[model samples]
Target: MTLCLSLLFLFTIQPSHSITTTTAYAADNSLQRVKARGKIVMATSPDYPPYEFQVSKNGKSEVVGMDVDIMKQVAKDLGVKLVVKSMSFSNVLVAVETGKADVAMSGINPTPERRQSVDFSEIYYNGGQSFLINKTDAGKYTSKASLAHKIIGAQTGTLQYNLAKSKIPGAQVKGMDKNTDLVLALKTHKIDALGIETPSAEAYVKNDPDLKMIKSGYSLNKNDTGSAMALKKGSGTLVAAINKSITKIKAKGLPNQYLAQAGKYMKVNTHNTSMFHYWTYFAKGIEYTLLISAISVIFGVLLGTILALMRFSKSKIFHAISIAYVEFVRGTPLMVQVMFVYFGIGIVVNLPALLSGIIAVSLNSGAYVEEIIRGGINSVDKGQTEASASLGLAKTDTMRFVVLPQALKNIWPALGNEFVSLVKESSIVSIIGVTDLIYQLNIVRADTYRGVMPVFVAMIIYFVMTFILTRVLNYFEGRMKHAK
Candidate 1:
């Protein structure tokens, strides 16, 4: 509760909007910093084709698209290497503003709302807007107007989303984080149509015969249609350099060349869209998931034990501190905590994404474990502690030898459940570009355009993993009972 209150107090006192406005032009040397670092990190959501998407080349996964091509040129011009970071579309701009990436470029439109938080390079490509629908519904819904009072889908935090909510009369707007998920929703008839940029809708139409596209038909501003790279506010020098690169590329008509290259890669992805074909992607995801779960479990136990002990301490300060931490963590969602640790504490120290994820999960799990351990300690017969005291055992010795061992035995099942939960919840790390199972699943979905299959595969894999862990835990429970 104390921790939660403190965080809430901080936000209440210094709102993010006010902070953004004040810090928007805080003497940025983003270009100089990039040159010194020798590499420019570009954050993107790799699910939007022609703009940014993932492709597997020679059995190795790679992010490729028109945005990538442009960033590559920008990097070359600046005499630096280009490093791409894949995350959700919503996190792309936050990544730049929070220093996770040098720039964000994933079919991003520079709307006024986005401009307030981040700067954008010159408009590189304007693909316009369109809606994707079932080919059978094409005749019924020829334009955006025909779809009024119907369910419309758009990517959350995009121009299409805003337009759908404001322009479409009586329309139900369903916003999702990924275009792939929106396409799935459209295919399943969960949404009547999906509002998307024309190039992406065209890519989907070309790739999937069941899909069709229609012009949005709304009078749009140039800013609403064009894609641009977003950078931290006050990055004047970096933005200027990138704009120069954009000028050269536009002058040379390189967007057409890049789009053609992206088309070929998309064809390759669709050539073998089988789930079995992308086993390596899933394999890597499983590996990272297990690594994160294992590390978090070890640290969670350590942190939980300390916090639980603190709660029992006679010192008011220690007890208050422990209470604050436990209450705060339990009150908040793990997703928010993950982002806070990754992007908030990140301002003080640059923690790697995987490490940040583990820390957040461990911290979150600790609160739960602390409560569980407290219950177990209470469950231990008070007579046992009394006997320990009668035996001349110190309080610490009693906790370590007499009470703790029995408490752990009583709480073994609860601890096992926590460990299993960690395996599933660790998927949240994907938002920070950690290649966990969920992240890889989304990548496969985007690459294959076979969304449901990847989802089913991931579900099965998770069940198998949790099943094995449960059996292992039951085995230990049996052994402990036998010993008793």
Candidate 2:
């Protein structure tokens, strides 16, 4: 099985290599495409404050920050509207690289490694480097030197993460995708300190009384500290236009103004930090979560039934294809599949985040459902099929009416279990910015600056959702047994 799977992976990767070769020969029309579309989509992770973060204004949630303000001005200069795409910080650059967004700007620092994949604009704002430590440990870990031989946390794929690994002697660096998660880790003593940019550290310190910020005191160039906008490689036209706008903004000191505005929004967010205050955020989260799961379930079952039928077919080609697809999907992680569907397949077809998430999840669930269905069908006695044939019934009718009814009854519990798992697994879509329960939970955590309470609320909500679904499934299962 491992050897077969290895061959399958090689076959799958072959097409992507060809796709890259084709992309290399494609013309660089990044600016022309955006202008023709009349809107430039900018991808960002909105959990970072004063750079890019979510805020409630006039009862509507919107992404806003200095990065957003800078992008807005860039859009204006180019005579186009700015569209914001929010996702995990790690996906921001991927969005631009895959044509999901025209650019990415989330207080991103241009490092040597990142420049290889994406083009960056001129340095915008240098927030410097700092470590977020517990207030109680203030006396023990005072500066960069004190953090030596300590466990340090930093966001993965950021300058801070690299610094934590290279600068600190014997430092066990724990890298996470989101800063809020790292903050929670620090509060729980999972790590001694969190390396972060100075402005973000200050924001966290101001909002949370238990946290304190200390300078990293490491030697760094402007590229290591300065924020910049990342575009797809070969976006010279767009990059030049963005740099021109940035130069003007810097000359007029607009970034300071934008930062001031973001501070006010942050103040509004912190004024009412209660979980109940952000019920709408959770409600919206529940809406999207249920939407993704419900659609995926329906499509998954349909796909599963087809695949199961294909497996039962006498044709070798049909059976081999079904086997390959089922094995491939079940072998890989759902997170990687979601990203592949969104960013990988997206190179050919521009799929929205929600649609990509639903497609990936349905494809994943279909493989498992196919197995459950196959087992259930096998459990049905062969005598039943012979009996149906004896009654002069067609093969299709016999299987659909007699075999399927019994199989469904046998697999009902297993199906229910898969559905329950789907609800939890759907949270993975949040990484692609689907705004499901987990995504909203992160937004609330970032907005309110209260991490634990929002997490607790989301946990209860998920439990309630899955519990209700379990009862409904039980009711149907009971009715099926009553018919017996």
Candidate 3:
């Protein structure tokens, strides 16, 4: 079974390989495989500035930082093309472990548990831990004992996450997928403080005056892994290639030079902040959010209508299938379905993120809409169907001409409510990388480091979207009511 699965993975996951330019002395053979595929894939979470972050250049966006520069040289030396994939930071190590990426280089530090799953390149940038808090709560984290009961936020699978759990005995340590989330949680006081890297803390403080580091409370850990590149386990040749590239880059002091270059791309000006700089982000978010919601609703209603009819059928098999589908979908959470389709099934079919999210959302929404539709059909007067039958009309025509139309009229309000609910719930798809409202705001919050304002804007956008959609649907329902 294991060998069969391995063969299947190789055939499916790894693209067609045309070997070229590989040397014979490479023992690990990862470099040879990469050469055969003709590309080295780098997986990163581009929210970490000065390491990896999105920057707009000449009306286009690109990921740039020290890690990117280092990995470009690695690809250059290996004689392969380079490809980059951005995802949540929590998924990077897993992507390498599962062979989703050849290497992950998003300011990740090694931990003992991570060492068991993947190999690490030599340490690159060494930095300490720091705490960020609202300026008004500057000294709230005076000491370790004082922070025992406070809630602290950190990026999941990081040294800061571990430190927060171990150092602060009674503090509630909430782990999120990105640094920007932790910072936003810090800004809005969701978490009493956030544990961030010293350099990242400095970046945030530099960009926004509302954020300040509590110096006395910040300390270095003996077990700190510093920053390093992660690769699939046992990829000895790839690790060596990356370390050699890192060594050369450092020997020429290119890391610091890269850091200086990245600084020039930061658009945030602490002296002059305005809405003109961020309108495009919220605008794009609104566009995609509406698109996802509209597509999901249309597909959902059509699918739901089918399921409802199956439930009404005389065939037991159809009824059983409809019942099972509705029960299974409604029993599970949307987030789980979204991830399973995006990352789990995505591996098998190579599904795109938008399609995966739409599938998940429609499947989830169909279950509830199925129930609404079924109830609506059942609520129609039995006499209506019997009257159509008395007039010699068939069941299909009876439903189409008389009963279903009336049933639909009865369920229009319910369907509109479901559509509204879906528009709001669509935010969950951002987890699987839809690049909708929430995802864009995360980058904006990190770029500006003025977390509350961007989040506030997102909240308003959501409200405006839902409100306008609700009003439009209500008007349609009124017209429908009067049409009869």
Q: Among these predicted structures, which one has the highest TM-score? A: 1
Across 7-126, the per-residue lDDT of candidate 3 in tens digits comes to 564454332234222432243688778989999989888788878887665655577777788788778978888788777787677567556689988888877777766778888777
lDDT assessment of candidate 1: 0.90
Sort order, lDDT high to low: 2, 1, 3
Model 2, position 457, has a per-residue lDDT of 97
Q: Which stretches of candidate 3 lie over 4 Å from their true place?
A: 1-29, 133-150, 188-192, 214-224, 267-272
> Tens digit of lDDT per residue, candidate 1, span 1-484?
4356446434432314644533644666888999999999999988888788888778888999999998999999999999998888888887887788989999999998888778899999998999999999978999877999999999998999999999999999999988889999999999999999999999999988999999999898997569999988778888888999999999999998999999999999899999988999999999999999999999999999999999999999999999999988998999988888877776657778899999999999999999999999999999999999999999999999988999988999999999999999999999888999999999988887786999999999999999999999999998988885
Residues 189-246, model 2: lDDT tens digits: 9999999988899999999999999999999998757999998777777888889999
TM-score (all chains, Cα) for each model: 0.95, 0.95, 0.86
Candidate 2 displacement at residue 402 in angstroms: 1.1
Higher-scoring candidate on lDDT, 1 or 3: 1
Cα TM-score of candidate 2: 0.95
Per-candidate alpha-carbon RMSD to the true structure: 2.6, 3.5, 5.1
Candidate lDDT (C-alpha), each = 0.90, 0.91, 0.78
Q: How accurate locally is residue 160 in candidate 2, as Cα lDDT from 0 to 100?
A: 92
